[model samples]
Target chain A: MIHEYLIQLLTIISIYAIAVTSLNLTMGFTGLINLGHMVFFGIGAYASALLTLNGVPWYFAMLIAGILASVLGIAIAAITARLKGDYLAMVTLGLVFIAIAVSRNWISLTRGALGLPGVPDIIRNNFYYMVLCMSIAGICIFIFYKLINSQTGRVFQAIRDDETAAAVLGKNTYFYKIISMAVSTFFAAIAGSLLVHHINFIDPTIFDLEFLVVIVTILVAGGLASIKGSVISVFALLALSEAMRFVLVSPALIGPVREMMFEVILILILLFKPKGIFGKVDV
Target chain B: MLSLNNICKSFGGVKAVDRCSFKTEENEITSLIGPNGAGKTTIFNIISGLTNPDSGTIRLLNKDITGMPAYKIAQSGISRTFQLTKVFRNVTVKDNLLIAKNTSEAEMKKMLESVYLHKPLDAIASELSYGQQRLLEIARALLKPHALLMLDEPTAGVNPRVRQELKLILKNLKKQGKTILLIEHDMDFVMDISDKVIVMNEGKVLREGKPKDIVKDKKVLEAYLGK
Candidate 1:
């Protein structure tokens, strides 16, 4: 039983590592405060689930889901290209509510809050599924590492540091910002597809504020603009949350207690180390 | 190579730049000098496309560039530095230059040395002193290909030694055939290096003449020191 639980926990961590790392590309590296990141994940999950249910192959469904999320990401970036700091944050936060409403109200397509359960598994065996998740996560991390070190990545950092200055240096800030959003959402959607396949279920709850908060917590603790920090923080936080399960002894209290723990850690990190562990750039 | 014809800009009810007109000679440094709020920086913003003119046209190489996006203007051969040093503080010195233009490592090092910034490429910008950061910003600006270089108060906060070095660097850039436009409060630096001086008062060109003649102009002296 313990072995099965460990495998499940590791799989979930790997999936979230992909999500957080992608979010870091926009939020940490590009200096976009994207509060509605989970909306892209939810979109990917629903797209994959519906496609697979309608007889599409699992891998193709996942790819299509990522593409769809990327399109939405580009649209959002173009619309909010002129906004910055708090205004941008508030606008992106609104996206979460909009996505949740759509998923809940679009009964004909999404089946409303009833959700699409029984999502097909990519691999029947739990151990093999975990391996698949880990492999995809590794690939995503490697890609992100290469991207953040490239010339284009330097432009992202420049825009983050000072948009006006970047523009004066002949960089098209709008184009780079949109590209960052597109790449970030693509990976986030892929993670969402992996998540739905692993658990064989997905719903409007995927767009929950709780989930967004959890992702933000991981990115903050990991440090902005740091992919390695995101990966490490995902593992550390998920392991700590799972370890708390043994101490709490009450399934009812686990959810709120876990959230509280995250809140405390976020507060402590902000208060003590505002840049986060391994954060090379300021938010 | 750059000319502004009757340029005007206003904020709310205030006319920040009103009927401002000037032209920069090719391969020479032209200084824009005036008292505080004389609309000097506003002219820079309008010319650089950071602000659209309420009226008039900006021409670079006789091409109408009025109201173009800042990046497009920059791509059209204008590189600029802000009055306040705007270095990418969190990144290394090398990354800052790379963002401007992806040049070779040796070229970037050479550019840095030209501006007397002797720091390691990997050193974070925020770790550098104020003067070093200014030098880094200048180096980043120079690293990009451009026909015109606009600098706003390049020696505002630097030590005297660095200020002297900046003078040498500006003179060297002039010798290299780069057209330079500058907004400066340091009269000595302006008078020493400027091939011509354009003085403004109340958002209009008060006087324009050679540095030697600008000092003797009655209107220019009144603009700087009230009657």
Candidate 2:
């Protein structure tokens, strides 16, 4: 029983690692304040779930879901190209509301509050599934690491530092912004697919503001603009939350207490270490 | 190599640049000098495509470039430095130059040397002093491919020694056949380096002539110290 629980916990961590690291690409590395990142995850989960339910294979469904999310990400980046700082944050946050309304009201496609259940699993065994999740997560991180060191990554940081300066230097800032958003959302959606397949069910509520808060907390505590920071923080924070499960006497208090702990930790990190544990770049 | 034909820009009710027009000779330093609020920086912005003119045409190498996007203008062979330095504060010196245009390590080192910026290539730009940051900005501008170079008050806030170094660098760039346009308030620096000088006041050109001749003009004197 302990073995199974550990495997499940590792699986959850691996999936979230993909989501937060991808988000770090835009929010941290590129300096885009994307508050609606969870919408991409939601889109991926729903797209993968819908496709797989209609006799499509899991791998193909997941890939398509990621692409769909990327396309939508490009759209959002283009729409918000002129906005920056808090204005950009507000517009992206509005995206979450629009996504929720569509998912909840469009009953025929999403089944409304009654989420699509029984998401097919590619790997039936718990241990093997955990390994697969870990492998994919590792590959994603490796790609991100390689990208962060490339010329494109440098351009992203340049744009983040000062858009006017970047443009004066002859960089097409708008085009690069779209590229950052596309890559970020693509991986985020894949993480969503992994999550739905792991739990074998996904609802609109699963990818709500609460989920965004958790992902953001992990990114912040890990540090912005540092891939190593994200990876390390994800493991540490997820492990901390899981450890709380064993210490808490009542299962009912686990959820509330875990949330309280995250808030306290976030507050302390902001007050003492605003840059985060491994933040290499200033926000 | 570059000419402005009756360029004008207005911010709300105030005319920042009013029918301003001048031409720069190829491979020469042309200085635009004016008292405060004479629209010198506004003219620079209009030429660089950072701000659109109320009505005017800018021609570079005899090609019409009015109203083009700033990046496109830059790609078309115009490079510039801001009135206030705009170096990428978070990144290394090398990364800052690379962002302008990827060049060889030897080339970047040489460019840094030309600006008299002796810091290591790996140094974060923000860590540099204000004068050093300004030097870095100039290096980045020079590293980018360009036929025309524009400096907006290049020595506005630098020490005299750095200013002397900048004077040498601009003179060297001129020897290499690069057309240069600059806005400077330092009278001595302006007279020393400028091949030609254009004076402005109340959004209009007060005088345009050789640096020696501009200093003796009564209108130019009156514009500097109002009648």
Model 2 TM-score is 0.97
Grade the docking of candidate 2. medium
Candidate 2, A1-283: lDDT as tens digits:
4488889989999999999999999999889999999999989999999999898999999999999999999999999999998999999999999999999989999999899999899789989989999999999999999997888999998888888888887888999999999999999999999989888888789657878878988999999999999999999998999888999999999998888877888888888888899996765
List per-prediction Cα lDDT, in the order shown.
Answer: 0.92, 0.90
My TM-score estimates for the predictions, one after another, are 0.98, 0.97
Alpha carbon lDDT of residue B166, candidate 2? 81
Local distance difference test, candidate 1: 0.92
Instruction: List TM-scores of chain B, every candidate.
Output: 0.97, 0.97
Give one digit per residue, the lDDT tens place, for model 1 in A1-283.
Answer: 3499889998999999999999999999999999989999989999999999989999999999999999999999999999998999999999999999999999999898998998898889998889899999999999999998999899999999999999999889999999999999999999999999988888799998989888998999999999989999999999999888899978999999999988998888889988999788765
**DockQ of each two-chain model:** 0.88, 0.78
RMSD values for the candidates in order, in angstroms, are 1.3, 1.5
Q: Candidate 2: which pairs clash?
A: none
